[model samples]
Target: MNDVQIRTFQVPGARLHYEVRGTGPLLLMIPGAPADAGALAGLAACLSDRYTVVTYDQRGLSRSVLTEPPADQDVAVFSDDAHRLLAALGDEPAYVLGNSGGALTALDLAARHPERVRALVVHEPPLPELLPDRERWRAVFQDVYDTYRDQGAGMAMGRFIATVEGDGAAPPAMPDPSQMPPEALEMMGRIQGNLDHFLAHVLLPVLRFEPDIAALRSGPVPVTVGVGAASGDGVPALSARVLAERLGVEPLVFPGDHQGLATDAATGAEIIHKTLA
Candidate 1:
């Protein structure tokens, strides 16, 4: 294993923080919602020996600062953030990996800016397009947004977290919003803002943005779709399957649930490393 160096770079107006490790082709990891770059710490360490792993705190998360109020917090903005980060790092056409919402952004980047991404590994993106009942999913997301606006961030987050954790019966008893650790609360607050933007700007547009299944299937770049083995027959895994089908490719299996890359980082890294090798 190599010692990793954590570095911060200024992206014109925003300060971006990233950890760089290893020495090979660049592999950028885009983290999902409710997590920062630290989520990929273990995975970065695991791949540090063979790959130049770069994981960063996305804008408005943790160490990264939002220079201006986001013009729009849609997937396009997220993809632009990624584009800037990669450009700042002097990395182009690199291997990009993203999970869940991060995957959504990566896919958009791959489709919109193919020249910047050499390959893309998407792990169970919760894209509404892949869902059989898109309206139902939209309703669910809307309900969550409404809950946040009406009840408050904490209550809504608790319910949202529970739903993600496979407990949709009722909202869990969450940490008191007022008493939460400053950092955790900050992240939660950003998440809440992102939730608002997602529902208002991204969801409907994304639902309509058809993934170029043919482009993905025949694009010059290599593409891989994977799902966590532990996700069972849930939406995440099902989404992965559908994506694979659409791409006319096979779906790869990883280690855990939605957060598998973080939870079983080492194993997940090895799987990803093998796939990208």
Candidate 2:
């Protein structure tokens, strides 16, 4: 393992904490959920020997302070954060890998600010636009949001996780909202915040955020869409496939479902490296 350093920097409107390891071409790993950067630690470790792995806690996450007014949590803010992080690190046109919501952010950056992105490996982005019935997905997300607001975080989280992982049958049994442990509730709050913001800004602005597929088609940057083999026949995988088709590229398979990269980071890193290469 190469020497690793965890450092903090002030982006334009936020304070960001990031970890850098190894000494090679830069590779930025953007985490999906508002969960800790620790989610990507295993994959970072696996890639540290071969690349300068950069992982950060995004705004509103650990060690990162949101100094800007609480704007709608849109992909634009996330893209700006990526741009700022790259500028702060003195690396432009770096390889980027994004999972789920982070993947959406990566696409936004690549589409809006092409110069900052060298190549993009997007894994299972939850892009509703790619779905045949995007409104249905939005409704599902809305239901989860309502669950959080009314029943509290635990019930909301359990339902959301189950929905993401389960077949599109009846929603699975929810955990007792009253009995949620402190840590679980804390994590749920983080997810709830992101969900609320996404619903308000990104999800609702589906028409506006629709990627300029035509622009992407004309752009020079190489983009790869990836889906987890274990994702089942669900929205994540379906969305990935649809995005690939829209991009006029084939969909690549990673290790697991939406959370697969977090669970099998080494394998995930290897797959991503291969895609980038």
Candidate 3:
């Protein structure tokens, strides 16, 4: 068993909260929007034996405190943050994994600073530029934002989750806010406070911006696009396929849907370990 040590890195505007566990090559895992380091705890525990697993709360979320509120969440800024964190770890090029928006950041990092990354596994990155229905999703994401502003957090989050699941099945009925467990309530609070920030700053900007395909293709680092087997050909899964096609590499299928790392950590870790090895 490895001890989890919490540390803080003072980047320009944010003091990022990161954890280091296990011992070996560093594997940095970035969580999706609205999820923090806690989201990666299970996966980190599973992989820590063979690799030094690291996870962090993105700026303005969880314990990663920011000096000022950012008006727009730029992928480049997020990538730079990842780059600085890797530099802080040492000269070794770290293995990186990003789920959803984190995947977008990973792609950005590989595109700009290929030397800092050894192998990047991007699982379910939502790149609008690659999809033919970019306009439709643009409207869908915007509706989520509108729900946040016009309706409220509960409604907005419901829509956001529904849109991402993209299972064609109708979303499950939202439980009464009052009957929820303590953790559920707490998460809702976090979502309520952060959803506006995420929609206004991160969501639209990241999906709309195109990653440097030419740079990724020519870079020295290895990039693996991962898709969840259980996630039907949703937008994110399709995005992964398109990215793999562009890179001329096959997509790695994991056990569960977008939240596989949290749901089925052991299997997800094994697949990732083999891929990196």
Candidate 4:
């Protein structure tokens, strides 16, 4: 395993906590809301031998502390935060991969600062606006946000999870907690603690973001949309397929479900390696 170097960068409204490992070209892995750098540590380790992998806690998530009170998050702000982090890291463009809500951030980053990104892989970006069933999803997400405000995070998260899990005909294939390593357990605990903040401030804004399709299409940066083979025809997979169509590219299939990179890092890493190769 490569020695992980933890660092911090001062952004406009918050201090960002980041981790760096491996040695080669830069590969920045962006995690979705409520998840910190540890969420992507397994994926990073798999890619470390070939590339310098960077993962960070977005503002108000985990060690990335806010200078002011938490409020509704913005995709542009998130992208700008990523922009500054890349600018500070080096002049060369970095390979960027953003998963779930983080994919929204990556889209905005590539649109706004294409010069900073060598290439981008958007893994199941939940852009309802891009989907054929936009209105339905919009109502669903609004209800989730409303539930957070009125009923609290527990109820809101239940609705959110149910929507993401699709049909719900079968129990979700989840890893047994008792067998997970200490670091994995700690990461799970941190994510649970972040739920309130995520549901209240992060979730809705991300789902509501309108990607700059025109800009992304004409930009210099190459973009690849990815979906998990096991994600089925859920909103995430469908949304990714729509985005790929708009971009004139086919959706890349990887291992596992929505959380593929974390659960099947080796296979996911190989797919990413070949895609960027």
- How much does each candidate deviate from the true structure in C-alpha RMSD? 4.2, 4.3, 2.7, 1.3
When 2 and 4 are scored with lDDT, the better candidate is 4
Model 2, stretches more than 4 Å misplaced?
168-209
Sorting all predicted structures by TM-score, with the top scorer first, yields 4, 3, 2, 1
Query: Model 2, residue 55: displacement in angstroms?
Result: 0.4
Expressed as tens digits, the lDDT of each residue in 55-149 for candidate 3 is: 99888776777788676877887888899999999998899999988898889988898888999999999886788888888898888888878
Candidate 1 lDDT score at position 20: 88
How accurate locally is residue 194 in candidate 1, as Cα lDDT from 0 to 100? 56
Error of 3 at 251 (Å): 1.0
Please write out the lDDT profile of model 2 over residues 1-277, one tens digit for every residue: 7466979888767788788988778999887655656667778889988889998877656567678875555667777888888877765589998877678778887887788889999888777666888787778777766776788656766666655665764443456778976755665566555554443344434323456677677887789999988777666677889989998899988876777886788888888888878
**Candidate with best TM-score:** 4
Tell me the lDDT of candidate 4: 0.89
lDDT of each: 0.73, 0.74, 0.84, 0.89
Compared with the true structure, what per-residue lDDT tens digits does model 1 show for residues 7-38? 88776446777888889888888887646776
Between candidates 3 and 4, the one scoring higher on TM-score is 4
Off by over 4 Å in 3: 170-193
Error of 3 at 142 (Å): 1.6
The TM-score of candidate 1 is: 0.82
Clashes of each: 0, 0, 0, 0
